[model samples]
Target: MHNFLRFFPVFASTLGVVLAVPLNVSHTTISPAPSPTCTEATTTALPPEQDCFYVPPNGWETKEPGAVLRHRFAPQQPFATDTVNYPAWNILYRTTDSNGDPTYAVTTAFAPKDISTPHAMVSFQFNYNSADVNESPSYGIYHDIKPKLWISKYLQHGWFVNLPDFEGPLAAFGAGHMAGYATLDSVRATLKMSQIIGMPRGADQGVRYAMYGYSGGAFATGWAAELQPTYAPDLHFEAAGLGGLFPNGTATLEKLSKLQMSNWAWSSNLRSVMIGLGTMHKKIREVITSSLGKPEWDWNTVIRRLPQEKEVSRLDLKNAVNTAINSPLVRNVLDYDTTLGSHGIPTMPLMFHRADTDQLSAPEDTQELKNVYCNSGASVFLHVHPNTWDDPHFREGLQACLSEDIQTFLATAFARRLYPGCGTDNRPWGDHQYGPIGAR
Candidate 1:
């Protein structure tokens, strides 16, 4: 809305060229209706077999609620799953990196119970994975344990779900933003697989789509929404829901480095900063000195090995890890200001939720986004939770705030009706914003 970037329709074909991802397509026979083919411009061919739309085979015995198969989003490197009832499959797939290195992703098809209903698809990306850099260790474990708690609420009402391991195969730091590309592609893959599975293709032709995520997953979902209109015009999206959002990577990194007094958070913050630095800055290690440093390892090493550690506290944060992020050079490189609205914000309805108690992510992160969006003549409804405090931590509170409402909101948004629901701190903050109790 701030006109941060020019709006350009990104047909799937154009994105394939820009990303250099070759496309392929194929067919399978397990579906209830004929699947759809790529109607949008696309350079990549659909995979040769509809099974390319993976569904995990063994662990999840297919159910009659019309559950299609999906491999556990993440199990290990070089992971895979198989197709089930729908000709489409679900999988944690792999593709070549820019350097031809294999990268893994969690990809799957849209499976609806009552195959006859015109079900829309939604992808709910899970938050950061402290364990693996490329794999969504968090999503993998959560999905395995709770198949679709959040999404099931939607599928029960006639919606398909396509969750992706956006961290690529490496689960690297800034991979959060890149997860958007993976989500869009996986969505594209879903659209194709739905067609291959022989599900009612036209049932969802121009069907409404919505994306929602919190924390790390929020980063991916925001990016995907930002990229969708231009990157995959053929795949229509109705709206996007982003909660506990981080608009400027650099800003969050700076705040974390200066707040080292906080124990549990500082290490993870440093870890994220290291990942961001690894992704964006090249002169990091050279700017860091070995002595008088709080970082655990030289800048280069931390970036390379983040995924190997199961926990951050055990990773020796007293060393170079802390110093690296607070390093003037690293901060200088990250100081560049930016916002989600800098790119074209989503074209459809937008819902952004932030917590007042969130010290890890400054309130200004979402505030600046609202300013950019509203100023751009875009209509966005901002929701802030006063119960969310600055110092106490807001992740758990945020999850409790909307796990169920998000599903309901998606259903209503797709239905083009006002969403009826209740949440803590639902009162408005000002003209259109919500929250800022102490600030008020």
Candidate 2:
């Protein structure tokens, strides 16, 4: 094992004031179980204490991806799912970072009331697309557009739901591979811990699972789906529901770049993509810093100095985005950092939705992705919705998939009643509705 303690301090110092994340380096790892109200350390400021940990047990990676390093119940607050009659388990499981290096991630599991009830597990990845560690799902912090209410419908159906902090420890926003790896591992951990967490006695006849996500979360879902065949052959997701997917890093940037070939002129998510990639690849970081440099608050120095969990305002980032747009070397650097089509094709049944009004990524990107997957004999159903939600295209696309239709789609999949759309490319967008899908 790499001397984690030897590098732990450096990791803490580099991120500036934030404590190091848990690492399960080996199968023999063990640590004193910590209380949910872990004494907040003095250094864990920018991020809330829940997101930071004093070093986890020595084991960083298990021989198996989903091996659980620790399991405990969440405190009597947000995770206190008891009000809804759902008991929650907070888990630390082995996973890999964007670079494919070993690490550990946190996932929260809420089992159904009749623990032994035959239920499918839902690996519901959320769109916590920010640098804030406190924003990680394990922290139980809810953004305004949070999908808990929609997820609640699943809970009401007695389905098991697992919410993973799939971005890895660094909150890598658009880091697809790492997100996918974490999603798979989180499922593994949740499934293995079901008995201890209280599953109904006989439901374990191989609990089937599926993945659901949108926007940034879809980045994880798409990557996770693509990687599952190779990185997690044991995982067999019955269905995957992806929305607002920004699959190709380059295509997404171009669509969002004000200075690039874009129909929408002012989206700066390219900066977020760069920041996320920087967390994994040093070369990418170097290119980002060179183009977006401003000694007083350059991308590198600011990132190196500030706590990653804190919000970086738009005004604070205008200079960097502008610099990247005006500089060819900087813009070209991102050309090499792509996400779509890199991971192998996923064989799971898939439902991909995008808003016709989405300005963040061109519709052609999804079409291209559908073609790629079909060429590999994968079943993919692509849908492009009309702008029903008047919000920004990105937000509209996000809400598009999280609607009642998605919940019904998931529930149907869990019940084993879903059939493939028999589509090789984009399927016609289903009509909008206020009721459960297909409820004529």
Candidate 3:
């Protein structure tokens, strides 16, 4: 039932950069490494020259978005050195930023070994919430121990799986427009790369594709789906599987600020969001640092861990908090422009899922997104777990259930059929027998 290309092997190589830094004796300051090495990717047949994986080669920058700047034949050999890697190509491609300025992004493209299953490509956006480009999926999957390990399950199924580093070069983590642009360009580049590589011959043109992500991942997918019609009309994305989508950073920040210290356990995620904001807007860094000055609540620690939302809520520093909130940098950076209905509606089917009760984030985030898209004439199926409400522990279970549902919907979507269509949220959560919840 499966095709085995015994001849194709993935050779492991360093990604050339690291996200974490080593500290000196004081344990207070981080010192950059003495030498930053250029990572050179390689396989059994071809070897990539040493250079920053993202930097474009000569003349590649002049091309349009989706043009392949460079590529490396590297495979994810996580467990051991000799284990066979599912054939994949790490690609750097030209794309645009939120401002429509030329930039570059990266993606990892792969397909079924069998290559004869009426091929479709599923661009799975990786939710890497950091300010470092080295932390992108293509680089982290090969280097970091915790880069969305669940994507491995996709390899077992026979389809093209493309993972895009939606955060552009500056690592503007929360800029939805940039995320969307990079994702669309990743698909564009992959279409061309697929044909040149000849994995599933002719997969380069007119192939129906699906998009998927959760939380930060959904940021990219959500924007891409919204921007597709106006920005990249040629893409045929039949369906998008989105979950835990927080479209506006300002809304999330306001919610966290209002919560009391009793709900501080989820504050670390707030810190992570702040890190993303800081990456995109440098002017807010000092204000943010002062706001998060407490021990154990520092930006760096909370970035690595979770913070207490009550402490971060700033009820005590009323005037100062208000000033920070109203600052130009904060307003400009967290602006919900080009998100959801602000642009154009997605013509494709959308499976939007949200947790009934999440202490770290508001359920209204997804609900609001659904409302806007639906009002704009987009076909959307919203899934809310009736039974899972108020259970903090259900987060993991919720994601797993959503992942399964997305895959199930993709089966129908790729067949050129609309997935259960709009207003179809009767499907049962986790059980799959028509209960409640809809992840596109």
Candidate 4:
């Protein structure tokens, strides 16, 4: 989730910004696109101007979100049936105001493309916004770009992609539970949009609705899956996939300070810790005020107070928690017995992929998640990679594995009661009841 590589130039005594260009071609081969009716479907009542959508007052359909605003270049290959990869008339909208809660918008490459019925729809949970001022160029590389890439791939399969700005009005980072609800509602809004447009979404027939996310996405996915059974029971989802899960935020703070990735992790952890402490514990407000020499704090105010590298070096996280514990504002919640207090249970199937060598998120902690839901009797699969450290977070391989596994699992998990390929041996994967392989 954290990119430690950004700091390399500081030690090398050179200063320059390096642009990351995606591979000229995607390495992972994708499935072919399905045919659609010749008649074009139309978009329904458009969302207000502020929201992200297909037909905003001004929008670009070809470029992905977080991309440098620039002229579009034609893709070398043609989309199926000569459909434009970046259609000229399609609209891309952004919605921030959803009454009071935080919300964001997303539109596909071809909004009005013909699809009589959709097989699945995926809504993404965006990570934190590190950029200081709204509309200013992002200070850090925009990591929320993955969802756009994923949406491109899903569109090839005729599935709709939904992107949600989970940060609400204040852009709440580390507010895991609230982020979850916002993500779910965004999906609901998309479904409502589909209905309004007369597009058929197989949500009632249990159309395979899968939730896929990485890191910040993982947190949103975890909370969404946990809350869906109760919150959005009418919406049918087959599976939920998560990778680079920073699930136990409290535990992660305790473990990651000494890791090689600490340089990057510290910033995210500090932001999340402060936000979580402030949002979850009422008493924490008083302590932070007394210790930091401030009268009150808001999201932006607290984020600005975050320590720089040198100051953070002198501070210890566990000790900080102790101080927070004594703070009149956070004492009660901090003193509350367990790390992850009893929360809602997840009703749908779950797929978690983790690499053994992950520095940002421990694989062991991820494996333990299966045990948490084992009693509920839901279908769960835990895929463990052989400690690959390709990504700074040690999660790139794990993210791919989770994506592939979830795709295969949902295709077969419910109807056939079958699991996809799994295990180090590369043998066939069986249902949860049978495990990946049978020795007999």
> What is the C-alpha local distance difference test score of each model?
0.49, 0.61, 0.60, 0.44
TM-score for every candidate vs. truth? 0.63, 0.76, 0.75, 0.62
Query: Which wins on lDDT, candidate 1 or candidate 4?
Result: 1
Kindly provide the TM-score of model 2 when superposed on the true structure, using C-alpha atoms.
0.76
Please report how far candidate 4 places residue 252 from its true position, in Å. Answer: 1.2
Better of 2 and 3 by TM-score: 2
lDDT of 2: 0.61
Could you give candidate 3's per-residue lDDT for residues 1-440 as a string of tens digits? 00111232221111111211110011111111112455544432211123355566777658988888888765443333524356677788999877677888778887555543556778888666655555567766765543334455555556677888787766666677889999999999998886654545442544668898766787789899988998899887878887666666666566555542334322333444555655555567767655555433444553433233344443543333445668776676567532455767888888876656644356666667777776776777777654443433235333442246667767667776563435535344545432222333
| Better candidate by lDDT, 1 or 3 | 3
The most accurate candidate by TM-score is 2
Question: Which 10 residues in a row give candidate 4 its minimum summed lDDT?
Answer: 23-32
- Candidate 4 lDDT over 26-96, as tens digits, reads 11111111122222222322212222221223343333322222211112211323444523112222223
Q: What is the model-wide C-alpha lDDT for candidate 1?
A: 0.49
Runs in model 3 with CA error above 4 Å?
1-39, 43-51, 75-84, 143-149, 201-206, 256-268, 282-323, 337-339, 387-403, 419-421, 424-427, 433-440
Candidate 3, after superposition: displacement of residue 349 in Å? 0.8
Mind giving the per-residue lDDT tens digits that candidate 1 earns over 54-112?
Answer: 32335432222122233322222111232222222445443322222334455644465
User: Who is ahead in TM-score, 1 or 2?
Assistant: 2
